[model samples]
Target: MEIVRPHSHRNLFSSNDAASAPTIPLYRSAPPLEVRLEDFESFAIDRLRVLKGISDGLSRGKKPDEMEKLVSELWKVNMRHQHASEVLNKDIISHFVLRLVYCRTEDLRKWFLSMECALFRYRFRFLTAEAQRAIMDEFDITCKAVNIMEFESIKEKLGQVARSMGQPLPTGDAIFYKVPFEDVPELVAGRRVLLSQGYAYVAMNQVVSLVATLFRSQLSKTLILTNRKWTSSIREQEKHRLTPIVEALCSSYLGPDFSQPKEYAEISLKDIDQLAKTSFPLCMRHQFDKLKEDHHLKHGGRMQLGLFLKGVGLNLDDALAFWRAEFSKKVGLEKFEKEYAYTIRHNYGKEGKRTDYTPYSCYKIISSTPGAGDHHGCPYRHFSEENLRAALSRMGVNSRAMEDVMNKVRNRHYQLACTLTFEALHGVPCDAGINHPNQYFNDSQKILQPKKDSST
Candidate 1:
């Protein structure tokens, strides 16, 4: 394997003449090149935007024509914004930078790998046949095209299987990939294609699904291995290089921006009840309701609601007081202090790990499973259809809006349901995807508050 080490102090792509230019590798490494912090952040954000757009497009279930247009639009935007000649280099570098930002924890790591694989699948699927062959060679993926003669011989069997799986078998004009039969469990389980002596004959249209699975698995393993090698020495050397760039990228769009306290400070514990009724996402709203009505919450509910309250500018003292007041109603003052005070302080970074825990993102909340008696997870995902509809109805979501949101939920687009919920409550289109709970809160505030008037 060729390691793509960038020259210490030069442009990755300088010459316009292809014959004279160096061959860029499939992946690029970060060089010890000095750059303005702004430029570094801009590059990473541009790539992040592309990744996010891909994720959003997938969630919407775009058709082939729409998907092609979307990818082309994203590509043009990225290329126009950056040096067009070094598009590949910029893409590779930004990916590595984001890996640093998102690799700090397990949830971030899963999300990064998932989105990156989807982006790769889109790009790979759109490549010309010759281009696909080159990439396959570069990546050492053993998958190969099944020629017309081979496909013709097996077309009948393939068609039979495809029909059984409720998928169409491609004609001779379409390409087929001969991959190991064991690799594509989705296709295999669906009986979507024929398996020969050892290979699964997958249609060109379905190839992306297989590639994405393999890509995500390989990339996930690589991240885990690389994380192990990221020792103190490596972090010390790359802290300046990696930390600021990732932080700026994340803070700008992907995650919470803790530096901006004024926005969150607009609301306090005093207004939480009213605000929960109006602004909180259904998951948090349910937790708040249960906390108030029952005067107790399971561990999961406490963690979910506690961090959200913290994100909404509830200070350590205020959080302690709020929980103490609520819990003391049932547990009494002494038991509340002994049993709950320390945990609340720990959430606020006053005890235990001392790590300032960020509130759960929409991805984290929806992906988590709530057990019996727990009301902490995304309602759209965890609730039964009847239960979810009832919950939404109680929250004043109109029937039409409830139907639309539930359709997305039935399709397992939980995040999109949350996005629709944002739209329903705020009465405006939220163009950006809803990925984090704090983001939902912030967006609600932005829409609810007048631009000229900060006095909420």
Candidate 2:
């Protein structure tokens, strides 16, 4: 520990036992560069969880606003989860390449389709006549593409997708009456194409537009709708109300669209982190950048550090440890723990008893965020390309394996990434040893005893 500003008061936990208790490793069991460098998107797996919803519902109009408001209200009520949500919304999406891989069997996949349609059709229903025909045409192309194999399984899955889309059958010519929306002239007689096709970029456009609209309306009323000559008291009232609304407006503006309605929730962390570097709040990036430069860390490393600190409900001591390990070699520990550590901790979430906590492990690092400060997770701009390469190299990975994993992530193969990484690391399936990263970490803490160099 760095020499402190000597205090006349003896400290509470700074005794020999405290120092001897083994300062929790700020970098224990840190996988080698190879293990840590699984495509940057891996860091975003949990952080971008909320984007899946934002990405999907963004196309809806008034409803997405209501949804967002509801989410905001939920955050207000469960302040404990706020940090986690923020992590998901901003931090995770900014870094990881999150995606959904369709790896279901034909019949099962079809059932999945039915479930989705049943769930989302009210908001983004079956395709319209023009769009349906277009989809059918595309379906023909897809079918042709699948001639590589029997593709019967794919055919069934496509049929499921069609059904989920509210199409009665596969987007193919079946021996049945093709019920085109064109057939129901009355359906379109007055509905001004109230919505667009499913394949359209619906989510970001719609949600963002609605949020934009409501935000603007609220802003105009609160900030600009006044006669400039209002009394001081009235102006004060307006200012008080306007401030929060304005902030919400700015947030909504930054948020994804709610109108266009398509959810390609393939979180591309590299892209988003770059955006954070270029566009996010300045105070945020410093915390992670410090970690990166000092620790030779990558984007994932920064994210992991942020996430673990957040997850463990780290107090001032642990928070200080984090910066000490990451930045001491560069700036010295005193500067961080006394100055930066407190700032980072305060930003992480509320400190004190009954605070939100999750296991500090790869899983939580990958999947925990509460959207507000209560539940912690995420470090700003923590990971970048260079550090990521180093971390992956240490983890027994190479350019070829990294390439394979990254490609899989780009293709939205979440499960496959987990499966492949596990196989590569353990020479066995993940199920062979432990089920989840949480389980692995719990066991590792016991099995992989703290080394002389490791933190307790």
Candidate 3:
């Protein structure tokens, strides 16, 4: 498909003069005047890689330090390479490329919005005071700071609450935002602020969260418009240009070559029991053990465990034989053939639709809500606090480490909890965040592998 240059729009060249300025363009489709054809796609993909890096870090429950490092690296490598004017233009242009590729489906739109929000939030956090003011003016963000003289009256009440919460009182020089009372609900719920009339007084540090919310709201509305604008035209030609981008986006989060037999072809049925014992993530290992003990797993467990084994290099024949051997012990071969053989073959793309299925990503696993008697989904997410703690204990996680993992789980940081678990199990710091179950397994394998001698 030909990548036709988009016709220039008026907003692409908006002036700084307020009197004649146009509305800020949300997503810029028009290419920059100086960019080559190769640069256009390269710029979008580079930005996408950055976005993926941010999302992947967040998905893995990366700490504030890790996130800040990611933002720093991104600025150094990508953002700093462009001029000041090109920075904003590149952000808009790269966004439009992904929008065109991802706007066709609800799932894609959701993924697109999430990564864009993360990207916007990260960039916003690093903007200088003057630059932030400029962006706010451009976007018509009128988040007013409360005057110091006016804040003096509420200072006593603020100090009282701050002392009660064991937080230091903001000094006379602290900056406060006069936001809507509803916007900073956490402060309101915690009674950390003074609410006078309708407005909530919030500290300057909390303003970024409010700003991020506003950015997300605006971007969401813009994406709806973008989806409508692009859906009708994202046909054969557009698909040709975007197919690789979509695949790469998926690969960045989902495991690569999920449907192929490259990494796992040498893995035979005899090896699965030992491999699973040593290499599987906690979620998959739990399922593997349960299937062995009970001689049955619910559909959810089967699907998750089945696809995982496939990605780990279990071939179709070995997969069928593996399941058959386990189930035949409980139900006999004839019954196993009648009830389960087709589903196993189906998962292998041997039956209807013939669609080669991929293993579920970490996001998919954690997000799934299992039904009764189902032991399929993420342990951190699916298990209760007590149950999760007990499970972690059995896996040799110390009480202190387990407490930390539990805290992450309680705060809905399941991926981070998994990372902590990975660290504890492997006894090393894993530099990369876990995005896919296959990634978890692969990382475990690498960590467990013996170090080669440099002399060799």
> Per-prediction TM-score, please?
0.59, 0.28, 0.62
Q: Which stretches of candidate 3 lie over 4 Å from their true place?
A: 1-66, 72-90, 93-133, 136-257, 261-264, 451-456
* Per-residue lDDT of model 3, residues 220-318, tens digit only: 776677677665654544566655554455334423646554543558687788787677888998999899999989899999999988887888888
By summed lDDT, the worst window of 10 consecutive residues in model 3 runs over: 19-28
**Residue 153 alpha-carbon offset, candidate 2, angstroms:** 29
**Clashing residue pairs, backbone N/CA/C < 3 A, model 3:** 264-313
In model 1, residue pairs whose N, Cα or C atoms come closer than 3 Å (at least 3 residues apart or on different chains), thus clashing, are none
- Point out the worst 10-residue segment of candidate 2 by lDDT: 95-104
Q: Which ten contiguous residues of candidate 1 have the minimum total lDDT?
A: 1-10
Candidate 2 has what TM-score? Answer: 0.28
Best by lDDT: 1
In model 2, the runs with Cα more than 4 Å from the true position are: 1-304, 309-319, 344-393, 398-403, 414-419, 431-456
Tens-place lDDT per residue, model 2, 1-456, is 111223222222334534332211111111222212222233333322333333323322227456555344432332222334222222212221111111112432233233222222222222344443333342231211223242333456445544655655433332122122333233234331122232111111122222222322332332222223233433355465333332232112222221111222122333434423432221233335544554534333444445433432334455556556766776577765565554444434444343433324323333445343222232211233465445445556567766765555454433344444444544434432222333332232332233413854
